[model samples]
Target: FKDATVWTSEEEGILVHTDVLIKNGKIAKIGKNLWAAGATIVNATGKHLTAGIIDEHTHIAALSINESGQNSSAEVKMEDVVDPEHIGIYRNLAGGVTSAQLLHGSANPIGGQSAILKLKWGANADELIYKNSPKFIKFALGENVKQSNWNSYSRFPQTRMGVEQTFINYFQRAKEYDLKKKNGEEYRHDEELETLAEIINGERFISCHSYVQSEINMLMKVAEKFDFKINTFTHILEGYKVADKMAAHGVGASTFSDWWAYKYEVNDAIPYNAAIMQSQGITVAINSDDAEMSRRLNQEAAKTVKYGGMTELEAWKMVTINPAKLLHIDERVGSIKEGKDADLVLWSANPLSVYAKAEKTLIDGAVYFDLEKDKQQREAIKKEKALLINLMLQEKDKGSPTQEPKKKDQEQLHCDSL
Candidate 1:
């Protein structure tokens, strides 16, 4: 049990100075200075506790983010290629991220499906999965998919129209594939299109990589024609221009903070994309496409205040509730509420400040990161590993047959795979 000034990510300016009780890894209760006689209590009098941040789009665990061999390669699953020991997960947990949607990159017109991972620090890859999480696919547009500015040998999708046709062709093939599978046709297995058929049947949602308004509108129409929806448009640099259309399509936007002009297609990218999308009643989320950017999501949310005059709470929602809703995991997380998973972060100061730090990060009522303890643990691990390695080398010098060194592959599911 712990007592803190909780910021539930509910109503604006609403902070509850209460005790949060945890039992069996779930939030047991939240009330005013409550007591539990035999339970351990940690006083959080000055810290601000809020739900752990969720990264809507990330590619941290995969061995390769881009499967650009073909334009529409939906057969691959990010889960199959997850590198459970990626050090990036630990860094993200230190930054207060508890959940992340590990997405495929925007290299193909229709990329692969994404994996919703829970940052269970020190857990195995299978354990990191958010069980029963909603399914989503990655589709891409603009220069990345079109290969307009990049000198690449990839075939097809070299133009905007080609990109749209690539998506249409994949869906059309997927629809027929679904019918064939339903009818028990002996179709030679094609893993790529099999995943796309799921999307056409509304089994999986789409998170597109888009920029220009033309491609944005095109993808929406394609989804509309198929009677399926593009769930969210990631890195929608030009989303401000088509906020109304996106709102009508019920598509959310996850974009970077003031990142623009890196490519010719992003000439019109604006810092106010998130705010404009919100103004049009379209769900908007500020995302960190880069590793460093994710650590300061609070500041990314603050950008809405500077560029679009959005209220602080609204900006906060862009990172918290709005992202959870978009990912279809709102019921379990994204807010510090009773009966929800006890995934929370305690901030030392106003989280929006550049200097703010995550004092502690908890997932399922277990402390995943403690800055001071991490430093100590790291040093201990370094010493132990050095000692063991030295012993192994000495044994090898003595020509001991039993001293054959173990390979890296034998490190069974170590933690920090978060």
Candidate 2:
């Protein structure tokens, strides 16, 4: 891209009238009046360019959300159920999101593992995953795991204290399992215990779904007991209350801009949670747990500027670099640095503003969503629909048998699905 106002999401902040060169799917150089012969030129004189948005928490590409057969779904992997043809992937691309962390639902005390994905629309399941991405598992606390919303009392750990004990029991079993394996003792292979053993051995990280401070502290202490760190806390509504504790624990916070008071546990959530967490030396990222909201995440970052007095550049990082850091993919696609993956978005205006539109969204230097192409596709669809309806009318005129149209079933599996 040429001659654009670059929001580097780095120490230099925004640069004006700069030229960025992307070569071989990596950012080659960034400077003024730069030119490469035979390279495509994008005249972005009055536009803005920034790193592609990364959603820290999402469930868009998953075919299923939960495995309720057991309270500890540690053996289930999110990668095994990826839905490549989901429309949410293309929609997120149009909204300038290039990457996301597809996590498991918050139903089990120990839920399924996570799938780190690059939003490569039209790709196959395995092709969409971020290669060699660090392992991540979902852990939950509070009401959902305790079955507070459900009338059934059959699920174990129906209380908050039971949630803690559940972890202790599993980790204890995993610890013994690890010891047996190290001692070269013969034993039956347990997938669930193997996954938990990875966490104990520091080979995998945890992203907990939590609300309120007590459970937050409880999980952190339990992690300490197991000698591993809780990597992140997603949907952390009341995180402001334990900002210092989280920072001391070296845990990152991925929170909503203003989502709160929707549930009993989130009654104390404040819009300033992101800013407060950042203020206390905690890495903070604003995440979208909802599919519809995931597309407009840039504006969600803008909300932090209003709610907590964060600067424009700082707020932008909340969606870009901070989330990348949380997902451990910052070294590849977070910023506009040289040699990094050329995952970028060209905007019609300042990206933080609601008025801005993603004119182009690119991953690995390939344009996946183009506004002009989208407009053309819309017109083409209208023409095709008209043609199809006309053919159907002709069939009716010929006295041909016709069947009523049946709507395709939409699949959206939540925690309660199982």
Q: Considering every candidate listed, which one attains the maximal lDDT?
A: 2
Per-prediction backbone clash count: 4, 0
Each model's C-alpha lDDT? 0.80, 0.93
Model 1 bad stretches (over 4 Å)? 1-3, 181-190, 378-418
lDDT score of residue 294 within candidate 1: 69
TM-score of each: 0.88, 0.98
Off by over 4 Å in 2: 413-417
**Positional deviation of residue 185's Cα in model 2 after best superposition, in angstroms:** 2.6
Using alpha carbons, what is the TM-score of model 2?
A: 0.98
